[model samples]
Target: MELIQNTPELSAYLAASDVIDHEHPLVRTVAATLRADASDAYTYAKAAFEFVRDTIPHSHDIGDPRVTWRASDVLEQGTGICYAKAHALVALLRAEGIPAGLCYQKFDVVHGLIAVRLPGEERWARQDPRGNKVDVDAQFRIDREQLAFLIRPEFNEVDWPVLFAEPHPAVLQCLQEAVDEPHLWQTLPTEL
Candidate 1:
């Protein structure tokens, strides 16, 4: 599917927001550590993706009750759901001046991921940083997407094509209102 940018300005994807919050010191520090190990933007992007995917345990996966909405909180506490992970990944990518945006998939409920326009690439590649499980092996590849869950059309799951500059209001609203992970899951929007 062709990705559509919500904002015409490419810079919007790179800009810091209250949620993406790339300018946060903790985000900067983590980005610095990842950047130091990476030789180029691609390596850095891959490294960043791997760092979040491998290091931070998906809150639901670990059954952590906390709910984190901001990118810095996700990085600092090392636990978050798919939307929070996507926020953390986007913050890391934008922290390094690489363009990044939020994307989503709809299953029984909404699932979140990120779309990155790598250096010099006009096309946006969506990557799922949702922590892997027994059958879900998400990878950082632009050529062919390595997302966590494949859309099962028969089940009515959909891949939303719009690449958002910030978290969708429906998502952000629920995340913000949720008191804990279980409450968050119960309240998750079924559609974008």
Candidate 2:
């Protein structure tokens, strides 16, 4: 019997890493739900994305001292900053065989989903689950992405890729077992 080789693309997106433990029971449950409910990859991606965005609260947003760095922990704790929430989203999407990675803005990043709105395209959208806002509703699509925070000029923000497989050690360290807001902020990595 010969070993079957996974395509590079499949391997990169689907394989579990330290932070993204897709094999965990919770992750598998989300994957199963996406598979059962969604008819296509795009639909599945949207469902998974919404699940995390709406369900999980940002740690700081909730004033929750505990910070989550792992996808499993994010699900278990139901609170995480943008990075932790993104980790959970990436893991969920990857578990469903959808290609997902981390994308960031300056002070506030786009979390896991990345898209460029094209001229007159209505479907590309994004959202920030960070808070509930009358003006900001959920946005899910590849065409007109609607994220939570508008990139402000005063922020001096930069767009970049932050994590792919695992939470960066520096980030993990910043959030690791933090018990309060002051400690969390004091330890948070600034290089993002």
Candidate 3:
């Protein structure tokens, strides 16, 4: 079941960040390109999600391992891990006036992405722009959630960060500068 929380405080997720960089030219350009002709919030959000998930290949999966942490960098480079991709999605959604935030789950390590407050829905829905792996495809669904993996207590994956108004800085930095795949995977942020 999806956890539903729609407090007035969620509005803070709409702000631009140093990492999210919603005001950056690349973010704006990419957002405009993805959201073209989308008349509704759901449509716009879906379009943005699809673009990020399919258009931007995962840094490691593409055999092009370049650490890009900022939303603008992710948009410009057309690749990133889940954290950077989530930052881009948050920037695009906030640019379009939708309230979006970051959420984290542990699998292999702490993976992250944007949690969108879907149109006409009080609860924020998870929309991971990171490309699919195995049987998982991060998608946009307002009624029920479909994410990469569910948390298992046995793994000590207990610290799930929800409702982050912006991307966590340590995560951004670790991903932004990682030079190789092993290091990237090793550097996944678990602290915040």
Candidate 4:
């Protein structure tokens, strides 16, 4: 399916999610500012990714119950654990026409981050919310060859089994649902 890029549609979707609030101001702001650029999808995705990575701090203790904190919270506070930041990134990228999705791996302290694959891209790379850099060639152990095209030389391979031995069942379920139903999340208007 084609990714949604227009502001009204994207904003409506995000507002409905209720994930973007005053706390997560950056997500909303970025979406509004970048929507006017008219740049290619990848460029918008990269810019949004970098902005989130630089803005939020990496922490393992921020989100309680591991799911309550949404992108809005992270954007407003300027600090979030990995999962919250990833959610914000996902919302922003999808608003700009990039085909971004969530992928799950078992991790001990940190929650799974966002993974975005551009159209016609062969590999899926992990998005580091702390660094704001895409590890194009990094391995998460699902399959190297399948992700070879997504690998980035700058990022060290992520050890899947060691990082996430027993993935959270709820998180895995959410990731699956998100990938399966790409259009469920909505974005709101800038005025709202």
TM-score of each: 0.99, 0.76, 0.87, 0.50
Give the deviation of candidate 4 from the true structure as CA RMSD.
12.5
Clashing pairs for model 3 are: none
Better of 1 and 4 by TM-score: 1
Ranking by lDDT: 1, 3, 2, 4
TM-score of 4: 0.50
After the best TM-score superposition of candidate 4, give how far the Cα of residue 60 lies from its true spot, in angstroms. 5.0
Model 3 deviation from the true structure expressed as Cα RMSD, one decimal place: 2.5
Per TM-score, the best of the predicted structures is 1
Kindly list the per-residue Cα lDDT of model 4 for residues 1-192, writing each as its tens digit. Answer: 122222323233223344433224565577878666736666676677767766665443323222324666556666554555666777776555554444433222224555565656654545655443354332223132233233232553233421111223454345334421222121111110
> Residue 179 error for model 2, in Å?
3.9
lDDT score for residue 40 of model 2: 74
Candidate 4, residue 151: how far the Cα is off, in Å: 14
Q: Using lDDT as the measure, name the better of candidate 1 and candidate 4.
A: 1
- Model 1 Cα displacement at 33 (Å)? 0.6
RMSD of 2: 7.3
lDDT of each: 0.95, 0.63, 0.77, 0.46
C-alpha displacement of 7 in model 2, angstroms? 14
lDDT of 1: 0.95
User: Between prediction 2 and prediction 3, which has the larger TM-score?
Assistant: 3
Per-residue lDDT tens digits of candidate 1, residues 97-171? 999999999999999999999988979999999989999999999898889999999999899999999999999
